[model samples]
Target: MSTTYLNLARKWRSKNFDQIIGQQLSVRMIKNSLYLNHFFPVYLLAGQRGCGKTTTARVFAAAINCANLDAFQKNPRLTSLPCLSCESCKAMEQGNHPDFIEMDAASHTGVDNVRQIIEAASLLPLLGKKKVYLIDEAHMLSKAAFNAFLKILEEPPSSVLFMLATTDDQKIIDTVRSRCFQLFFRAIAQNDLRGLLVEICQKEEIGYDEQGLQLLIRETGGSARDALNLLEQVRFSSDQITEENVLRVLGCISDDQICTVLYHVFSKAKSPQKLIEYVDEIKLESFAPEIVWHRFIVALKIAVWYKYGVSSTGLVLTNDLKASIEAVPLSQAVRLFDFACQQEQLFLKTIDKHLFLSMFWIRLWSMVHNQEAEITSLVTSKSMVTASIDSKLTVTDQLVATSEQQRVTISANSSLWEMFLEQITQVDDQLIVSLFTQAKLKNYDTESNKLEVSFHKKFELFQDLFTKKDAPWFLLLQEVFGNGIQLNPVFESESIVQDVKPIEKKVVDQSKKQFYQSNNSANVSKKDIPLDISDKTAWAMTHALLERFPGTVTEFKEETDE
Candidate 1:
């Protein structure tokens, strides 16, 4: 019945042509039409969500009505500021206005609805100069409805005006869209969003850090509505907004953490399966893999650009990208960037991201091999740096190892490639046994320190699931092999373990804390083990903690904690 002090979104809703941000092209065209005093039969506004197409149309309608907003208190209308004293504006505000109609195409998508509206359009405006029709989510209109709307658009009545808003224009029938003057709405940028959020926070007297605002802007992905909602959540949680709160509330992974993981995974030879381990966690947070992957490619591109001293503020690269590009090499950085782009294309078009990732790692390892090849070929063929080459090889060999014992000891020096191999050979060998049985290891290079395998499946998850860190098998591996040591499990025939334990667990009256099977196999719970951090999940987590977080994990198996 009444208006409340407008929230950030409504309070700052665009008033006129100049108020809308980052939509210069749309604004210019619309304003020119208004100034020229020429009106299209139908005006279609299309783009991604929260881009303010509806606001502009409202403003245009209000201006036409010469609506005064002051009469309605805080509820201001853009047209003539929507005259509150006028019966027409009052009716419109009440949504009972005969002259102003708001139709949600999503609900009224039937042809009958379009026919009714068209029939109404034949008559003159009862309370205003021009009858205004605002159809939201126009893409939802049915085929017959679209045909009716199209015929109307193709031969629109002079007294009627139409504004169609949609998040996706492609879904709208081409013939319907063709008759309307189309204006595209784009996602607002981070900086603009930051400034907007700051202004709103100040207006609302909500305290927030610039960093918090920045995070909200980034996490909201330039949707004004989403950003405002997040800002409101921050305000409600605490007057003071912190980065921690932003991450927890928005479930946004910081650029730093994402980059750290990206660097470790993309720079060196690591399995894409490792990335997938976090996918479910991310999905639970409502994060899209396609978006995250695209964002990562942007980060890699920025890193590449930074290495070359050429900065590119490209699309998909977020606000945190520039800082991440520091200290990277041009060729490798660019290679990774290109790889990310290629990977994104594959992920978007085909579900075969696993193969794309495996190929990527193989290619990166090739670079190291190529480095050695270049040196050796230069030394032998050109007779140019044989001594230097020999010395480098000596160091590499040392780094490579002291003996086969040390060479394949499940250490972190195996470039992640060999680390994976070590797990299968000396460790559980069960998971890899399955993969190797099914996989065709077409190539293995001692010098390159890489392995190539192929699978018949088209989806990436086949390879990813087999080696994901959260997978039950991963817990088993981390318990056996450690962290930083990757395990790229390719799918193969299931490793048939015939080494049956001599125990069968039969239900017996409880006497012992643990039960022994007929095969002499013991199935013990964590209770049987010492306060036993014996669960595979917990064990894997502990190892990860020790690796990723150093000083915090000081000592392992501290006498009592178990």
Candidate 2:
């Protein structure tokens, strides 16, 4: 006759407090309570699933009723308790202890079940000194059932001990929770979890790769049961556990594959067709779309972290892949991460997951491609200006030219002043050009060699670029116009009010009036102001809006009280 095979999770279930993994605090507290011989009438164990709450409860139950618990506690050197050799411990381990009753509150959530437990609790222990009731998923019990058992739970007989284990403690009534001695179990740490898996693999005679085990550890998400179950699945699928086999069994993409996709997306490639080809080549469609998206999100998040030099020890990336990810800008990585997160909700709701995923890849490629094109365009323009400046004059030549020009007095309205403005326009910086071009040459005193440049109040925030001596724009200005020229920057009202002719002002004021009237009138259509108006401030405002927004202006009615 053949014996039935047991899976790794059940085969390796924690038999005692010592065997329990990743819950040292709870185990120590329970053992300390056992040593003092002080037992709480009601004990509450709460945590996420598979973090050893239920296991610890069972161990505590067995230890309290063990025949040799007193002998084990008396010795300081022996840390292991429950004395598995004792008959009570053996019976509890075999699930045949009469004094120990284990209940699944999830199945028995009604008041009738609570009444039966209450009646059972009224009786004394048959096999041991103390009777223990271990309730798993205690949070699933209905409010009525909790109420029915509250009296017994609050003040159980001295011979009976009640242990309640739940993933969610909040669902349990506050009165019951207040009565119990609560112990929270935290999720297992990754290092401790990895050690556990390594030990299990060695004991089971399972061959494994480091990367394969790391993947298993990640997939487990700090659950020992999940880790063991996943390991069993991988072991049964293949004799030797490897990353390739893990991916095959899980039907998920590898980190390298994700890095490859990110590389192509962040690369100079314009089309996503290559990405589609690569996906088809890898047979990505065979993998679950949800899992693919989940991995993609996680990979992007890791890339963002790596880009910032954050310590990401668990991320298994090749050196080349790491370099590629680090090569991408932090802004781009953050944007991709944010976009992926935003699309996740939509992706889950989408029925055509494959189509949505393909489009997602395309959108990512488009974002990077468009951003790259813009950057390239800006760089090209700046590079051309830089080359022109470099070819025209050296730093020494520029100083000489400025000194020569300074010897001759130049008025604000003179041709020399226009040439100075033209020289500023030739500088490689766009912000300097934009600001200086918008500025009005307020005055130029030839005696003091002082140049007063005034800007509209709207542009006041940029005054530092011109006033600061160490600023790049200021240095460039000095290099071009000579160090003797003192630049005083000031903010004033629009130049139209101070400089425009009376007739032009009237025309602009009328145009503004008509603009506001059009916006206020619901029946009227939007009308374009005449381009011939010579109000530089108005034109500057219009040009700024057009350049910044790059769209047609639509009329919106202003609300008014009747």
Candidate 3:
């Protein structure tokens, strides 16, 4: 009542049946019903909040009660379009129309209100052509209220109509819902939001930056009223809205802060305290922990998308992630995103809220430095890998002793590739040995040191077993003695293995350099990769130390927001 010009949400409110956005779908069904003469006494509009269910129901009430809907009845779409110039439309808009009765179920939420409303349904139209009952927040109605009202709604007077609106459809008793025609409204789209904001600015006579408008739309996440209210706040302080101003007003973290944390994650920083402290500093800038967590989640998701050669424009992301993320590896970024999302869900659903935030930072740390601080301890626990001479997997033989050196020879005498078959049989007999199976070597490249191996479709079982990354453990000749060499483990989409290529000089010297490179995820750098181990003595030394210095991880600070 105090404002001069109507804001966008009010000024642009649907005047007719067709003007409603994200709800044209619900309008069509009502129009079709009107055209076919299949009139229902009550209609239920249901969806999440800020999704146009209540708004569309209001427009529907006006349409059916339009005083000037004379010749438009043939084309039902025109029949329900209200003429606001008339007494009935003007009265409905002001919530004073005798025929257009609006009720807030939250206030009139008992059996007594329902009994009175049902008794009023017996009367004919008091002012408009038809009486319309608009019930908002219908889910809040008590069971006694719904049970009492259901009778009149299911079989109402011919002149009476009922419209129920609710954010949660599940809370509405099933008996009441089944009697009424239902319509579902969806969330507004980002592009739809952009046009809505620009239209609002032009109508309100407010000057704003396009980037600032983008920030408003991104921040609102599909709620038009919320976005316009944010715009109103920005206009109060300054005529021209800047990106920085919007971030400040919204208590949003900046792109610089997002990038700062990301750099630590990528560098495999061990100090979890540093990341937590950085987040705490942002809190002094008045940013909420939830928002800080959201920014990181958005940054991580964008990084993953960028790595996949995809663009994040128009995607749902925090504005703080605008230019900070775009070049991280897809695999690593996705891994981080998954970790962030898991934490986010926990933060939302858990009573242990403090642990939620702690887990968030720890997850990022663990992505790079997840294993125990000592390499020897981690390898020894698995028993799958052993420490080599100096905890280096550049070469090792936990599978066999150096003394069991049986030089392998491939005789070029059989069409079936006898040498390859023998190697596969030896490996398969042992359950732990997984690698290349009963297939011909096909060809070998000594110059490039690449083995050109192929598996046919008919031999699917053999192909799966033979081409697996774990195949090398079985002493497959190509993997074990490729060009007179032992290979470091190689990780591929199809397999994980240590490829060994021996030196061309001497057998004695080549065996001495037999190294294994045990790998996990490969998107990380060598230094960031977990150090591999093979010998038992080093692991024993490190485990003892870790036990002596038992590490305890606790929350660096109590949660700021309850």
Candidate 4:
């Protein structure tokens, strides 16, 4: 004779409030309500999936209709409200109680189904003192169905109790929600989950590794049902549940593989070919792309935490892996983390996940390499500037040397500001480049390391863009200038232009007119025209643009009043 096998998840389902893990507050509240006999007409239980919302509803339903409920209510301290020995408790436990109705709102999400529930709720109990209705996934009910339930919920029968369980309570209509007493359930704590797994392993005589169990808990994301289901799968896959077996069962890439990828990502060597080869190897292993990507994201998070000197107790890192993670700067690690997070949805949506991941790896490699080159260049330039400053310093007077150093530092900052402006044109976004170009460098204060940029009153939008801390342009400013440097955005007053001297304005207007006339005249010689300060600045800007873009000037049509 062969006996049938039951999965751990179903076999270990919570039978009572005390048996429900990770929901002490909800259990206690329900127990207290039962003890006081102060039941709400309707109750709303909401939480994440596998966090025991539906299970709590079942337990609460049984407790209310239990034949021995009066005994617990009188005692005030007895937690076993539903004496499972009675006929009512036995019927509920076997899922055959006539008075206890469990409706799946996901399937019967219609007005007619709700009408049937309302009609039945009006009838008296057949097997117990009170009739209990458990509506699972109550948020799945259609809007019309929720409206149909409003009247019955607001004026429910004295002997009828309605319990609604939902993973997302926000979708439930406000009218229905207003009538229900809400109880929220939180995810199981890691320690509580660990203890539950330990007890299950002991009871089932399953051999396991502590690290492997921790990995399971991490993957389950505080879902008890998922944890038990995964545990059963791992148990049957191997004689002993170890980290390697768990990884195999989960179809997740191993930690060593994840570390290898991180090493290539953060290492100084440009090894795109090796990274692609490794990705191909991962694909050959038949690992799930989503799981692989998720593991990579998790590894990046751990690397970021390590980079910031925050120790993660869950992860056990080898010395080499720790060294590799520690070698990466916090900024680079955070960028990689953000990139991985953004790519997750795209990776899952693509049909050819391996191809997408290969491209992703290449892009990530390019980003790291580019950032490394930029940092190296910045460091080299700073060293050269420092050498020049030291070479010019005199040893005769200490105060004079200090003053000279300050002047050189200020000069270097001015050169850095120019470099920043030149680099802005290289950005891929033309709109951002145009906005940045409109900003004038008004002042640079070395004392506060502040760069005050003034925008014309007409460019208020550009000024607002730079003021936002999360804006990409603002972040780029900090990246070019040191993190300590601050940006002060000033908007020039509309009337400020009226303060300019008439003579100076006339000279500027005359210089601009001559410059345009010279460009438009074919008979004029360029050398014969003397250049003013404004003309010199324009020529300098044009030469810089030509040097950076390396293009011929095909057209030079000046703007005119048409």
- Model 1: per-residue lDDT, tens digit, 1-562? 7866656677677765556776778877775565555788888998877878788788667655644433322332333344445676566555577777888888898999999998999999887778999999999999988887777788778888999999989998888877888888899877777777777778777888877777777777778888888787877787687787877665555666556545534432333344445433444234444445555666666666666667664433333443433433344455556555665656777665534444554454334233333233333553335445564456655554434333332222333333344445543334344544444433333344444455445323446455456655455444333333354434444443433566544533342434433225444232222344446555664654455347433233312222
Comparing 1 and 3 by lDDT, which wins? 3
Clashing pairs in 4: none
The lDDT of each candidate is: 0.61, 0.77, 0.63, 0.77
What is the alpha-carbon lDDT of model 3 when measured against the actual structure? 0.63
Q: Give me candidate 3's TM-score against the actual structure.
A: 0.60
Off by over 4 Å in 2: 316-329, 371-562
Task: Report how far off residue 348 is in candidate 1 (Å).
Answer: 9.7
Model 1 spans > 4 angstroms off: 1-7, 10-12, 15-18, 67-87, 266-295, 312-562
TM-score of each: 0.55, 0.66, 0.60, 0.68
Expressed as tens digits, the lDDT of each residue in 194-213 for candidate 4 is: 89999999999999999899
- Could you tell me which 10 consecutive residues in candidate 4 have the lowest summed lDDT? 524-533
Q: In candidate 2, which residue pairs get closer than 3 Å at backbone N, Cα or C atoms, i.e. clash?
A: none
lDDT of 2 by residue, 1-562 (tens): 9987878887888888778888888888888888888888999999998888888887888888888787767873565677788889899888899999999999999999988888888898988899999999999999999888788877789999999999999999998899999999998988889888899999999999998998888877889988888888989899977888888888888877887877767666334667778877877788888878888887777778887778666456666667666655566577678888888889989998988988898778755553334334444565578678775657786677555443332321344345556777655556667777777666666457677777889887666567567766665555444456688887988662334456678899999999988677665443544345246455655555565568655444444444
Q: Model 3: how large is the Cα RMSD against the reference?
A: 20.6
